[model samples]
Target chain A: MGDARRALALVRKDLLTERRSKAAFNAMAFFAAMVLFIFSFALGPDAPGMAAGSGQTLLQYLWPGLLWVAIFFTGILALSRSFQVEMESGGMEALRLYPGDKKAIYAGKLAANLIILGAMELILIPVSAILYNIDLIDKLPALLGVVALGSLGFAAVGTFYAALTANLRARDVMLPVLLFPVLVPVIVAAVKATTLVVRGDLMGELWTWIRILGLIDLVLLTVCTLTFEFAIEE
Target chain B: MNHRAQAAGSDTGRRVVVEAREVSKRYARNWALKAVDLRVEGGELVSLLGPNGSGKSTLLRVLTGVTRPTYGSVELFGAPPKTSNGKRQHLGVLPPQSYLYGELTALENLNFAAVMYGLKSHDDELVEALAHVGLEQAADRQVRTFSSGMRKRLALARATLHDPELVLLDEPYGALDVEGIGWVDAFVGELREAGKTLVIATHEIGRALALCDRAVSLRGGRVVYDGPTSSYEGAVSGATDSVRMEAKR
Candidate 1:
């Protein structure tokens, strides 16, 4: 098989595995809901107080931060579980022996991660809307665009970091330790862009954030694809 | 391509499929393989026998283009052991560890490996490979649920799926049971019959003796012995005499 076909096979394998277990998706979605719930309880039912204290308008304010937080934390949870499934069944070594492009391996993994995190975002959006009492109906397309771009960036970085941490000693703590620091620029840009969209602000400001996200995605994807051969080898 | 050029370029030459010229691997502290020169010709079943920390796996990695030698260079199919799009196509490696994805089923693992090798006839080949390893029944079962022996079989299936020209088995039979050993032996015999080159690293000297035509021994990152498996005892005795001489020095 060629690169594209090999990559698709890997993607199918990952998705089928997840479809069988459902553990990864469930854990991420559950964590996203819990985070939203925690924010709701912490802020209480006082809409005016939340609106006043958070600065900008309520709908414009909470949406970006909430979406980012959900994506970030959910991304961490999902990515950590990414190779854990492979390790559990002793399948990683088999994958390394295969003659496919290492980039295809990363792509397949990133695709799976994107799907899981995307599903988490789907759940988190409406939950955040209900919890923060913000009307997100008009901003659906923008929210989705943010989700796509943001998740792409997150998945790119997250997949590489997850592979790095897979065989490390303190993987649980080390994953976030390594991942969060590198992801600061990505999260900042995504959250900022998301805020602009939420507020119905000028597209001009949002384009800058989008560009930053796109750059982040491209750089991380290239670096990860090239370096995965080193990561997977013994 | 003509038959001779194809045979030379192909993984089926009677001459060496792999050649390492003054290959050395070093970290910050010590050298793992020190200026090692070796070759395993096509259709040669060579066993790498060594104790722990003896650089058996490192040498195999260099041969498979997984790890680059620090000092010198090695070649697979007359090309340098660097990651190339085509070099990997002709090589199959079964790492000492089970490098499969446990979340996937045996069939999925085989399918993934087959596709990566650009095996167009993957579906039929996967089925045949699984059956060859006695894994046809467990093909669809998640690898996480597999026993060590089962995982090894799945790995073997993956390695042989594409019918690579050169097969590198690093402790391939480490996890196999009694019957599993027979299965692996049979598989190796089949590969030899097909005229594919084999480089196996194993602690079990008897198994190596049964499968490999020659055995290469390494000690403290150096080649101490290189000869036929039938003369393994003579080789070990010579290795002991050399070590004794080194002690006297």
Candidate 2:
């Protein structure tokens, strides 16, 4: 119970800090919008599908993958920001001094990252959908489920690696380098599930993809939670 | 050589609360702390005096298990830090830097600490803790707007909010103005009066000598002087430029 309270306190503290500063959020939001805009422009305004003559533009066909790419890239900012705040304020050591299960710190950080990523995704989905000319109103329910699972998986590894590299001098470059490889399985699972949500699952494989994503999230979350203490230690 | 003092006065007969046996800490190629041993009993006030880079902060960090010793051991309540994790509920540490978020209000910072320490969050009590540090008036103001002294005072409040039995304050009086230094002095005196076991690592030689029951001076990461403050007072009053000078052969 104490650990739980500590975790909740951490979440509250992190969110309040982020809300007041808006440093990470603003940068991530702008970057996500720019990624979408650049991709939409590069894909050349919905030209006929190059590889598939299914009467869909290249952007429409690739919307799901492109969206996740943007998310993962911009999402790195949110994940890195999670631990950056601690470093900037010189609070990490002070945080470790607090008595309780160190796992609570991991849990708290993971929760805060999820909330921030969730908010970004909320705005992101609508903006990207309008840009890609895809209808998500009907797909919103299913899409949300896929996004949530993918985000959990993403944030799980993200929070872990963020802490692992928090002390590094080259953390800005290292976060993605270390995170992306470990996140391969999660990325594959998340993108597949999201693709099915965006484009109709003709083979009815959405559940299969969702299940894989869920399992990956579970494993990543477990491993990250258990090993978090080591990463955050001096 | 390690010095073990059976502290006299009221601290006598108290159980040992902190024990560091031949503790040595190495950072890469640098030996920040050499073989050093010290025991702090309950209700005892011990001052760890050292020059810069003499391993005072490193020793405090090792004692608190914030950093591990490269050699030897540190125990709290007669167990290693890992097994004694539960005992840390009664331990409080104030690091050199104020960890208070500049964006958060004073009350909110205390509230965060209360929740982290697993203490019940009572607004009235939180305010009282702030008031104890003369910060109740600044309770709602953002800490970023605070002066260094104000931040240090708030850090003190946050540290003791859990009513910890063993409080380790690193440089408690550093970076403070005269008034702020006096405030810290008053606060430390109160902690001593309340019989709280304390290990303060600082360069405030005079203040430390006056308030501490025992003095353990460190040089080159080794205990150069470990004795009661009364005897050390005589050494200081002698023809010595500084405590470190007397510590020399």
Candidate 3:
């Protein structure tokens, strides 16, 4: 089979698996929502407390970090799960033996993570806005664009490291440690662009942040594509 | 594709499907396989038999290109096994684990394997394959709900979906019931009729010797015996020290 077709088949299979079992999807979605709820609760659920205690409402300054924090933890949960299913009964080895470019395997996995994590953000983004009383609907398109770009970078690096640690004993703990340091640039870019879009400042330095996110996406995708075959081989 | 390229010599007109010479596979601490030489001809059904930790699965992995040997070499068809996508185009392997997606329905699992095996549309073939394994009624059922025997049957259907020429079966009967064993026997019988090559790794020495043309036994990563299957009884029973002792004679 051609590379594209093979990759599509794998994507279809993985998505179908998630659709049927809802294992990763349910867990990540609940986890994302819980993180948001906890954030709202910890910050006292209103602007008055922040204003009285710190001279500024918590959501006004912390929403961007909180949003990305929710996405980051949720993405880590989903990323760690990407290869865990395949580790069930040697499913990873079977994929490794599939005909054609091994990069297709990585592509399918990265795409699936992007789609799943992106969908999670779709819910979390709006909910995050309401909880923080931030009106983000006006910048929805730009915000989504930044989210997609950032997810691309995060998922690419996350997918690669997820595969790397799939067989290890402490992968749950190791994935975040291995992934977060490498993802500092994407996180910073995403947080910066998100803050800019939330503040309705797309014209000035927002494009630069988006460009940086895109560059991180491109670089991680390229590196992951080139190195996946070697990383997965026995 | 170079997959169909002809090797120089033939095994008396039979195609040499697998060739391994001085193949030694080592891990950090110990050898998994050591100085083992093996050859399998086209249309031959061979049994690789040994006790636990005797490298049966390791050898199967090396042959199917799942694991690379630390030293020596292996060739599948006319080329190295490393060319898995090409050389293993017609290769089917059932590793010790079923290697299936438990979350997927039986039909979906077969469809995934079929696509990977390069069959463009396997809907009809998958139905027929599932029926062959007596899993037609369970086609829409998720594999996690199925019994071990049913899973094995599903694995069998997936492995043979593309009609592979050479099949490597690792513990094909591990979780099988009597009926499951019978189903495997019938499948093997059919493969024999079609003249497909098969390498089976099993601890069921009697059954394997009865079905296979030749028996190759291993102990401690070394070949203990390589001969016609008929002599398996004597070779296994006569030796007092080690199975390797009788094969040396």
Can you give the TM-score per candidate against the true fold?
Answer: 0.86, 0.95, 0.93
lDDT by residue for model 1 (B1-249), tens: 011121123343366778888889986687788777777787788899878877899999877776678888888888785555476777888878778776677887777776767777656667788888888898788888999998888787777777788999999879678898888888889899999999999998888987888877777777777777787766576675674475366
For model 1 the TM-score comes to 0.86
Model 1, A23: alpha-carbon shift in Å? 3.9
Give a tens-digit lDDT track for model 3, residues B1-249: 111112222256888888888889998888889877888899989899889988888998888777899989998897887764676678888777888888888998988887776677657778888998899999999898999999888888877787889988999989898988888988888988988999999998878988898888777787767777886666655432554553365
Give the per-residue lDDT of model 3 (tens digit) for A97-183. Answer: 666788888998998988899889988888878877777768889989998888899999999999999988998999999999999
Model 2 chain B — which ten-residue stretch has the worst lDDT? Answer: B1-10
TM-score of 2: 0.95
Model 2 agreement with the true structure over B20-55: per-residue lDDT tens digits: 988999998988888888888998899998789989
Looking at candidate 3 chain A, the ten consecutive residues that score lowest on lDDT are: A47-56
True contacts kept of 3: 0.67
Write out the backbone clash pairs for model 2. none
Predicted model with the maximum lDDT:
2
Candidate 2 scores a chain A TM-score of 0.97
Please give, for every candidate in the order listed, the TM-score of chain B alone compared with the true chain B. 0.88, 0.90, 0.91
For model 2, how does the per-residue alpha-carbon lDDT over A67-137 read when each residue is reduced to its tens digit? 89988998899999989989988889888888889999999999999999999999999989888888899
Considering the true interface contacts (CA pairs under 8 Å between chains A and B), give the fraction that model 1 also has.
0.57
Show model 3 residue runs off by greater than 4 Å. A47-56, B1-10, B236-249
